[model samples]
Target: MSSFFAAIFLLGLCLANAIDFTTVYEWNKFDFVRPSGVDTSNGQIGQHFHQDQVYFQYMAVFGERLFLSLDSYSGIPATLVWLPTSGSSTVPPKLAPFPSWNLHMKDNCDTIQAAKGMEIDTDGRLWVLDQGSSKCSSKLWIFDLLNNDTTELVHQFPDSVVSHRYFKRELRDMVLDKTPEDYLAYITDSFSDKIVVYSRKMDKSWTVTTPGRKWNSLALSPDGEATQLYLARYFSNELYSVSVSELKNEGGRAAVKLVGEWFNIPCRMLIDSANVLYAAFKYQSYLSKWKNISEPFRDQRFYEVERLDAEQPFTFALDTNGTLWLTERNATGSEKRHKIIKAAVGARSYLFKPSTAMTAPQAYVSGGETSDDMKITQTPTVIVISLLVCCLFLCGSCQCVVNLVRMRRKQTSLRQISKDNREQRSALVPVNL
Candidate 1:
């Protein structure tokens, strides 16, 4: 009976590992025929240049359309393309420029210089981060997907927000907070090592510079009430988190705490309904999942989902139907081909499981009280002291109690020093200690 049960358990584990990630589309070079008489000089290329002049930088899905943004780093025109999601052609037919050609001209106010990253909200609105063309200012553009197969520009960041700083900045990725009372947008400026926050209600924005060099990716915690923001640096394996409430209250250079660390620098991350964080590595070409977000990093909670043989997965998107999509780009920038892959990771329900309560780290403030969410809770020393006092009342052995108290005090002091060192390393600004 014991052997039979063991065999059945092993079979179940094997079946769970059988899920395969399917490659939906791959192209050596993006080949498609444009409309007749379409000029290839300025913004009228018949197709993406056969050489490595064009590269797919980001992707997003809305309804029946699958949208891709082309990188302008190679001097190609900044453009976005959309095709029917149901089509499965080796070379996609009718790949049309998004919005319209009128919006792509240099003199137009709606012209996009370069779009590096994008996000689609729950209301079907597309938010694009324009990295700024040579002649244009960096801005964020929001478009509403209308029912008539067209889009309307709803909002654009003012010139005041983009032109405030004299130094060059590169806005990379964004995450949205759609709480009822607070609708905020957070964007990462990789080049400047800053995080920019925009408040929709107030129509205002602010910037916070972090301690690291390349702060690339951002994700919101699964908890709705206490929505903490998770940030990952590009070249480092460390992951950090900060409270959204604290950021809004204390604006510039707010302190951040180290939450978890991963094996590789994650290029893109997605937090599912179950609070599971899925990280995609750029050069490593493997997908990993951290199951328990509140716990410290451990090999037990981290699982390697799948490995891409040769392709490097960059940007990722989760569709309405719970399908995961990734853009596999040529990491070396030498290969001309790229791909789009999809898989079902079994997250489908409308209701998300409540996230486990996270223990907040101790933070030092200048004068004001520490934020409620940043306050550290009961420590092991408190429990030990309480037990020692109880023994004093019950048995009252003076010599034995003195030795135990001295030993615990030494241990507690050592622990405090270690914690202080960690806190110093995690602060966004230099600490006096």
Candidate 2:
């Protein structure tokens, strides 16, 4: 019994060590090409054609539509391109001028240079943030697809908002309110350390500070009850977040509370139907998923699902099925149309990185049974069987020790009996002689 227990215990330990490394996602790059003789106006151009245009700042997807904003220096012709779900099905989707938005006549691709962030409103109005003129410009362009017109310009940062201070090359991205509201918008200015909120009713006239000014990229929680904001430092690759109640005014003040932080640089972010955050950073071209971010998911928290190193541009949107849509820009410069790759959450490459909350061993260990239950509630039952086997083996090891002791005592008795028999036989033979 003891030996059996010992064997079982050893087996349990070996099984524990035999667990394979956790599964991580691996992504493949899909290339969409331009059909022969197709118009490449708003088409994606790679470094092969324009070596100077190295950066693709922002990209957004609404329904079957896809859009991207290029850098001012990028020699790429069109500022933005619109893509669809079904098409000629052969080459990259054709490109046309992203229909002009508010301030159309005043808006030139030059003034709208370096469009960093974009959002599509409930009415299908395309809102784009132009870091305008490498100087201070607080204008956002709104293109109304419903009316096929440029509706209105939202001035997120006005000279008054800047308080007469010169903030050149400001304004990064814009985050839209998720819950049904009166159309509120949040804009981040990397240089100014502030987020400007604009209301559509006011015609983009008013500007207020946002929760965090240090980083860019904001996401709406799945329930649309709160906002998740990401602040990524360019220098150190530190990514953080702040959560704001979707319904609450920033305490009558524009303030952001920090919540989540990760080690890598998160340059861009998008939210899925479940509210998981997909972060694309400059560290590597691979996309990562921060699954199930908490409300007010603040800075210094978030899990990393998986990442790809291929130099593909990252963009996010949901398909008709509400599955997350991911597109990557090809830098190979091999095709006329910059590739627009599509990936659904079902893709093998899709990953879920639990927040430190999920992966922190110490936190769970310290939390007692409640914490352990919360952590593995969804895990399979095989884990319990494994534990039981380990326990059984440990119990058997004690019985094996007892059986060995009894076997030793029996051997000693046998030896004593044999010695006594031999002495009696010798005495009988001597007396007869």
Candidate 3:
């Protein structure tokens, strides 16, 4: 009996270790190709393209294409582009622009001056925050991705709500309110340490400030309503939250409350529909997850999920396919190149409601109960049959343990998989027609 319990415990440990992210798509550096047939790798006339100048910051998966936001202020060909989902995981695909090549013109008021963080809504609309150049004012750009990438809304921030010192780059991160009453955007303006709130229905903007500056990441709880806005500041382990009700005030006096504080400083944060919170520490090798928001963040509630070669997950996103996608840190001196890593979450993104959470069984769930329940009656013949069944089961217990060990070994060996391992839809064309 003790041996049977030991085997069961070993199987549980194996399942926990199996839920991890492995390297999928990787590149020493990114490549960009414009719609007009201009390749950045070709070294065109008067064009300067440096391999060290460009790096990806944030990403959002809409349907079949994974959109990436390039965080570069100079020498980058395109700041916003995408890669197909059905391509070779080993081969780095040439990134195609989001909508068109013309929209990426630098310092143009009519185009995206600087592409920063972005989020995709359930309606298939891509909401982008553009840190405008010295030649243009900061603005918000939304595109109807479901409708041929048509223009949805373009609004410029007035001087009253923006920081005079860092107006061109103060906007750091933003999260949309999921309440059905009205649409609001809570954006982090780190230059002045303010949370800029914008109302889509009223077309008005306001600002809210918490304790620390350098506000880096923002996540909304999976309640499917504007309950709390989770905020993480750089170089800090304490997480804070503000009520959406108080944030809706144009008066700009929303109260900031400290919710949970742990040992790890979460550089990036994400929430799944199951209400599990993920945190990726800056320059840290391991990633963590918090199961309950109601309880204080302690070692018992927060668990380290994975670790890889001291790999740093700077940016990440949870998709509907039950995958957590992230970008690792890369440097010119380091032998490792920039790579896209993924893990199995077994739950959809927080963008979906909890009741509507979509899930697919993954390696974490593959080793679950695979046998059916048995029943026995009072008959002597039935008792004899049950004894025979129990004798046969006892004989096969060793094989069951062997199969469980083999299942875990199989998951560990094949770390890398080609394509998005979940479900494959028709790949989106790289070029926009």
The prediction achieving the highest TM-score against the true structure is 3
Off by over 4 Å in 2: 1-55, 100-111, 134-136, 149-156, 162-167, 178-181, 205-213, 223-230, 233-255, 295-313, 329-338, 346-433
Location of the lowest summed lDDT over 10 successive residues in candidate 3: 368-377
TM-scores for every predicted model:
0.69, 0.57, 0.74
Q: Ranking under lDDT, best-scoring first?
A: 3, 1, 2
lDDT of 2 by residue, 127-223 (tens): 8876655343546777776675454564545675443333544666777764455676677666655556667765654444443345555555443
Report lDDT (Cα) of residue 393, candidate 2.
64
Could you give candidate 1's per-residue lDDT for residues 111-225 as a string of tens digits?
A: 7666767777767777777766656667777777754534544344445444423246667778777777655788887766667877767766777666664587877776477
Model 3: how far is 14 from its true place, Å? 4.2
**All candidates: CA RMSD (Å):** 19.8, 12.6, 20.1
Candidate 3 segments exceeding 4 Å error: 1-14, 37-47, 88-90, 164-169, 211-214, 224-226, 299-312, 332-336, 364-433
User: Number of clashing pairs, model 3?
Assistant: 0
* Backbone Cα, N, C clashes tallied per candidate: 0, 28, 0
How do these models rank on TM-score, best leading? Answer: 3, 1, 2
lDDT of 3 by residue, 124-224 (tens): 88888877777777777889999999988987887777743344456767777755756678787666567788877777777765545557778887764
Model 1 spans > 4 angstroms off: 1-17, 36-51, 88-90, 106-109, 147-167, 211-214, 298-312, 330-335, 348-433
